[model samples]
Target chain A: MGGFGAEIVAKYNYWIYVLLMMIGFYAMIAKRNLVKKLLGMNIFQTAIILMFVSAGVKHGAAIPILDKHEVLEHGVHAASVVNPLPHVLMLTAIVVSVSVTGVALAIMQRIYRRYGTLEEDEILEKIGE
Target chain B: MSGNLHMFVMAAPLVGALTVNLAGRASRKAVLPLVLGFLTLSLVAALGTMAGVLEHGAFTYTVGNWQPPFGIELRIDHLSSLMLVLVSAVALIASFASLQSVAKDLADRQHHFFTLYLILVAGLHGLILTADAFNLYVLLEITSITTYGLIAMGRGRAPLSSFNYIIMGSIGACFYLLGVGYLYILTGTLNMADIAARLPQVNGTVAVATAFAFMLVGLWIKMAFFPLHGWLPRAYNDAPIGAGVLVAPLMTKVTIYLMLRVMFSVFSPQYEFFQHPDVQNLVVWGAALGIICASALALGQRDLRRMLTYIIVAEVGYMVGGVWLANGTGLTGAVLHIVNDALMTLCLFLVAAAIISRNGSLAFDRLQGLYRRMPWTMAGFTLGAFAMIGVPPTCGFFSKWYLILGGIEARQWPYVVALVFSSLVNAVLFFRIIEIAYFRGGKGHGHDDHGPVTEAPAMILAPLLVSAAALVLVGLATGPLVSNLIAQFVPVF
Candidate 1:
């Protein structure tokens, strides 16, 4: 039990991400308002981005950069620099999330224009009528 | 030159999209021709890539001449090569048919529609060709965002459906990204082959299993397999006829292809099949259930286009079950069905497009005396329906044959039963349409009485005929296709 508790503490960031993801997921599925659902989606995506950014961290390591002169004088230690790939990947993911949000907002505007309501149930009622 | 063909396949549509945006601003008439020209260029390049793959076997091209593990790689094995041709061919044929519908439905937004159309095509080509897991995620979003835009352009509840799609699609994509992140943390690589190589060292780790689960679930949502399918029928049904012809045929099929890539390429067959028999069994049963339920739902739809959407859901079940059956024959059926179902769906949707263009509706009540009004279109529809019912000499039969044989070999009786049941349901669904269209005289709509044979315009008719012909041609060539192309790609189980 002590070892498991220590492990949980050691990886608390992952638990936070999981909690954030679940919260976002709940909003996306359960929220009645379209804008709130979009917000939920954005939150969900942010949680993923955070998870990816956290994956790149190495304890007591510098960001992935190298001094050319230092590298020439002595080969650099690989462990001294954080992994850069996950951060790079997260940048693309952030852009995708933003674009998705933009498209969602645009569609929401259209939905509002047509149905005059952002509530899904009300919109369905309007569509039915 | 052959080595650079894959680059051309990805670049032509992208460059064409930019060119169309600029040139189309000058002359709206230039949009269709420009789109077709670029699609033709890409199709030719895809054919060249397929030829090269057939001649030289599978090969990889590194983007910007960077070495693997660092640079993005575009891998063209037998499977992707066939898919490259399929994507390009379908895009070209579908675009040829889009000109009339675009002019009629989206006259003011021609350039915008074709721009999204070209980008969607490029994104699909990139999705098929990319070997990096992260790159695949990026391309998936590009295709998805463009689809949302296209679907939203339609009138009446299309924006709502597109909105729903955006939510579901984002969740699917984010799940995929999360899975990739997990794999990266485990293996320290983003390239698929690299990750697969490194995975064995940590094969038994919980993270690997979690990654696989997340990725598979993400793809299942994207493909709309079973319970994850709520967004598909409405999105496709309410989409503008122009977009429907392009998206309905390709989107789910391509996602299924990606699932195959994830299962076979990123994870070893042994890992996928032998690691968890219980999970595999559960998935196959789920697919069986999905088939029956989707078919039943299809029967309840009053609209013809909506029914077709449910049929797509059922077909997704077929391919998913085939892949999970974990035998050579089953995998072959899944792969072949991917091709056959795409063409079959394309043929059917094109007919729907033509009918909608002429009649302005696909409500079942509106289809009376369609055979007299649009005989050629109905003829094509018959061919497609026959294909869907798995009649011999149509491509759908051969794939179904393989899938059933596979199910029997694997003793997955439920999947086998579901296949037969779906076919019967498809026959009922289609023949009901056919009988209505063929036998019932036009009662309320006055134009149908003594109406001349007003087939779809030549542009639409030509592709419809080509796809309908290709269905039979593909069925006849199934023997060579399986032995030469598909058989090579089936992983040794």
Candidate 2:
């Protein structure tokens, strides 16, 4: 029990992300309100973005930028810099998430206009009618 | 010129999309011509790329002259090249048929619709061509976003259904991104080839296994495979027929192609098939169950459009099962089915579009006496129905034949049974439609009400006939296609 607790504490970042993801996933599936569901999706995407950003961390490394003269003279060591690829990839991800949110919000407005409500059950009932 | 033909294949649609948006604001008359002109250019370039690939083997084009493992690359192998042609050709054919429907559905927003349409074409082409794992995610989101916009432009409950799709699609895309994140952490590279190379060194780790699982689940959700397929039918049914004719056929098939890419390119077959026998067995069984269930659900749908949507779900099950069979024959069938199913689905959707334009509804009751009212349209519909039923001389039969052979070889009897059962179900479903259209008189009206032979316009019939013809031609060319194109790509099992 003690070792398990220690392991959990050591990798708390991953645990937090997983916990956040589960919460968002639950909201997405369980919520009755369409706006809430959209919020859940945003939270879900944010958790993943955080996971990706965290994956690039290094203990004592500096940022990825390097001085050209220093890199040519000393020939830089790979371990001295935090990985930049995940951060770069996450930038694209953030853009994608924003675009998705924009589209979802636009569709939500349309749904509200047509059904006069943002609840899934109510919208479905109206569709049935 | 040939060396960079792949660039043209993607760039043409992209540039066309921008041109449509800008020129459309000036004059609506230019929208259709611009869309068609660009799709034709893309198709020509795609054909040229296929020729180049066949003549000189597969090649990779580095974006901005940046080498792989650092810069993004577009890899054109036999499978991706064939898919490129399929995407371009289907977009072109569907565009030709979309004119009347688009004017009817989105009369005010035609340019905007064409803009989204062209971007989707470009995004699908990019999805097939990219080698970067991260770039694939971006392209996936681009396609999903464009699809959401297109579907929302539909009438009635389309906005609500599009909202559901947005929720489901975002989750799928995020799961895929998470998987790529896991791979990046382990391999320190975002290139698929680099990761595959590094994976063996980190084999047996729980992280690697988890990544594979996440990625496959993500793609299955995106492709609406069985249990995760709740979003597909309603979304496709409510979508504007113009968009339905395009999205229904290509989106799911391309995602299946991505699954194959992930299974083979990012992870070796040895790792996928040999290392995890238990998982592979479970997945194949799941696929079989999915096929049976989707086919059963398809049987219950009342509307023709809704029925076709369920058929798409069943077809997805076929390819997923074929891939999970983990044999050369099964994988070959999956690839071939991807092409044939795209064309088959397009042909059927085109027919639905024509019928919907005339009747404004596709409920089974409205279809009586359609055969006499529109013989040419019915002819195309019959060809599509035959293909769906796996009748000989249509492309569907050849692929299903290979799949059954694969199931037998793998001793997966449940999959074989499921395939035969689904085909039989399809026969009953399509024949029921055929019987109504051919035999029954129009309801609430006399036989005289069956008006003159006012067929769908020539624009719609031309593409329908061409696709119907391609069904036979593709089936006839199956021998060479398998030997030349598909055989070269199926990983040695």
Candidate 3:
């Protein structure tokens, strides 16, 4: 199975995650467009969420529903449960990322209102005033 | 909970931060005491935990009272308790020093500043106390998000900087989460102690190395380690003096502390090849370059605050170097330097803020006669400068002394040279500002208004003095303090 896992190789989701992360990071660093930066930031965060969800999935595994009868049994009793933990954790992270994004975009709107431009270089020029 | 004042102490400041926000609407004067009272309580709790650690092995408080693997735990070992004390102590001083600047800068928004400050405090407290790796990630987010907010509330351009900060900061946090996720997938656990226990069984795998790389890279980003420090200088430069007080001093130090913990605690030294000399060699070279290179970068800066911001980049090098030394002396020095650098950085920023507040800007030429008009402020600035230069009898000296000795002990000549070169560079960097403040910009103006210039108001001065006193006290008792508090906490790795 481990050998089979090796043979099955990388998927589209993994490629997209890496590409999206790099693009987001590049937009953040290279682009001087403030609005473009926010869009980039959101794009970057979405990639991580993708990574987490992708991690939880296997080639073949059922949803992590526990067997009800094995109440307090320990050693290897509940194998192949494909881990509900990552999914739960990722849910919280998504909420947080979204909440912060809302606030950031509002601030971006205010910045545009004040500066009359979304270009970072122009806003910086005005600030230098 | 008998002799264990640990829970309450850490909890109280956060409680104060939360409650003060709620209560600030009722009375403004009452707010300071409320916050101060909790910080004092946190300090007392730290001392109690210290006593607790000595008596009982270590106190662990799992959230929701569940078992370790299933629940989030707040562990108060000797190391965490010391951090609690240091963070609270700096926080107490900064909060007091904050009143005037925050009042002037934030005004009706005082409550908001305090709220973010407390939340940041809570995050720092959480980071130090949390026993679980995944839990650390959550707390790290809380800190980073609040830090962005705190930086955003500064005078101007703050929101822009904070926005940029969030982008970089989120990437760092995500990297950390990925690292933790990797570990969990490999080891089937998230608890630090549990991971340490289990890792030895599967020591030489590619998965663990990848996990280590992921975690280290994430932490390096947070620590604003040289190349990854793109977001830091502007964030510091743009934050308000009061908010700057907190972020500039403690945030990166906490990140560095966590890096050390991960390197030593989560992946034990003797148990694995995670602490390979190859990794240490790579990191130390990065550290040395950060030290020398960032200092050189600072020399080119024209803005006073921007220069200080670059110095922070250099200081990270100092601490990272000590950690990579892999010796008790160097680790102690790095740990000790964290507190020392905090004081030095805080002092420099406070003085620069005073200068900026006095003048309309922090341009180098605007600082002439600053020393004469604000003698006490200049005196404090002088001490901080000398300390940054690592002069004898200052806290900075001892930190450098130990780090250099570690360099010698480890037979790393380049690191020792980097230390000497950086010290010389810092002297030039800080004194350049002093010279401008004195010779070029020091001419007295025929004005009577204080107007956020001259010496800082009592509120700001109070916290400034408290940290300055810590600088001296650490210098005097360097031997006993680092041994009892930090050295023992040093992970064998």
Candidate 4:
């Protein structure tokens, strides 16, 4: 319960999210292929959704839905249930990410049809021609 | 009743998009009338909303009778309504101007083009009106995706450019979502006003600073601030004239408006992030560098549309720097430039479209004798170029005047120098085109006897004329627009 072990245990979720995000970001910028960049974008978006959902979790908390009998017997406590707002927001984010990936893939298909290659520099050379 | 007008403005374009899709691609005649009908309706609704704001100052309309921190709200303040008026006005005019180009450039894909165009319109309106932080991201993606669709429909090399745009734009949107996640975790509210009230208590935390940095960088990239502007020149150059006219005017300008909105409404003007001298210096200096570099890049362009896109990057620098100057005058200048730059860019792009439609090229070498070829379009282009150069009695001049005044007040000499230097660069860039077109590349040929003066069709020339005239009218009326519209709403630290 002391020093580095305690600190890592407390914030491991955030650490993982940040790590995944950096990997995605690096692939997006440093990769050569169009499909790889698209994958990197998806990974980046998924990492964000992960961060949001993790932020909403609480230890020893029940589902957000309330039971009438429990509410009648004992008043509802805010901390007893996981936060539902971030989850709802992330649902929309997930849908947006899906659509973005679909559109990106469609555009990549067109690029392939036009230029016959998916590499960044190769496409440029084709365009130059 | 006013809220109903606001709701109608957001809904009409969406309804039109669906109807146009259902009408089928065979009925090409039905699309333009339907698109124009919906845009006109939205324009009337937007005007009503603006009148309501003028009468009532600023107000909020809650959805489903639910209060803030829970259900979404539409905040129709002076700022949002002003943007609404500008967005709808430009949409209507741009759609009108698209009639000829859509037929010429996208003859077969007319129906699909208008459908996506209307959806992009609806998304922009929603983005400006929403009070929820999460809703803005949703609408931003809607606009961005529709833009990608529209831009990809262009003639050549467009697929590659649009794909590059998709990659860069997705990264920007993801960064924005990550920033919003940070803010939501810090304060358990999704409403902007609620977050603003709760933020000061946890002011200087690392999380808050990180959130600000993320959001700022994300928006800067989306707005194509200097270093991140790689996607704009190519994408806009390759896009069809119709989509280019609509997206070019509204996209970056709206993002700049969002930056101002977040600075004032979501983060409070007095927040330490804005008040920190080092942070302020860094942003202002970055904006300054952006101006010089973009202007320099523009000087090297041969294509007219590509050069105009670089000018957009430099104009973004103007607005961003004005806002970061952190004075009432600077904020006013920023807001004023948002309206003026939108009109100026619309005018210029419309002229480019007209020239391309007739002359079959936007390259400088092909533009020889254009002044005599299309005199009316050339006149409009002249007004737009003068505005871009910050000449007196143009709207651009007034905004630049206020920005320079703000720079002097803030003692930011570098921003002032960049402002003056960019102005000179714009003059040189624009006049070079003028030299080529008017003098026919110095051959001293009076008029080409073989080619007659074929002006653009009425649909195209009319909007160009109206927008060019509006630039001057807006400049003349800047006194009232500031005192009545922009001055009262600027955040006071």
lDDT by residue for model 1 (B342-414), tens: 9999999999988987888899988988899998999999999999999999999999999999999999999
Which rank order by DockQ, best down to worst?
1, 2, 4, 3
Which pairs clash (backbone N, Cα, C closer than 3 Å) in model 4? none
Model 1: residue B329 alpha-carbon error in angstroms: 0.3
**TM-scores of the candidates in the order shown:** 0.98, 0.98, 0.91, 0.97
The lDDT for every candidate, in the order shown, is 0.93, 0.92, 0.80, 0.89
- Candidate 2 C-alpha lDDT tens digits along B1-493: 3679899999999999999999998998999889999999999999999888888889888999988899998889999999999999999999988877897677889999999999999999999999989899999999999999999999899998898999899889988988998998899898998999999999999999999999999999999999999999999999999999999999999999999999999998899888999988988888899989999999999898899999999999899999989999999999999999999999999999888877667899888899988889889999999999999999999999999999999999999999999999999999999998888876565464778877887778889899899999999999999988899899887
Off by over 4 Å in 3: A1-16, A58-77, A80-82, B1-4, B55-57, B270-275, B357-360, B436-454, B491-493
Clashing pairs in 1: none
Tens digits of per-residue lDDT for model 3 on B355-436? 6555657877766667666767777788888889988788999999999998899887888899999999988877887786
**All DockQ scores:** 0.94, 0.93, 0.49, 0.87
| Candidate achieving the largest lDDT | 1
- lDDT, model 1, position B316: 99
- Give the share of true interchain contacts found in each model: 1.00, 1.00, 0.34, 0.89
Candidate 4, B306-335: lDDT as tens digits? 999999999999999999998888878989
Q: In model 1, how many backbone clashes occur?
A: 0
lDDT value, residue A39 of candidate 3: 77
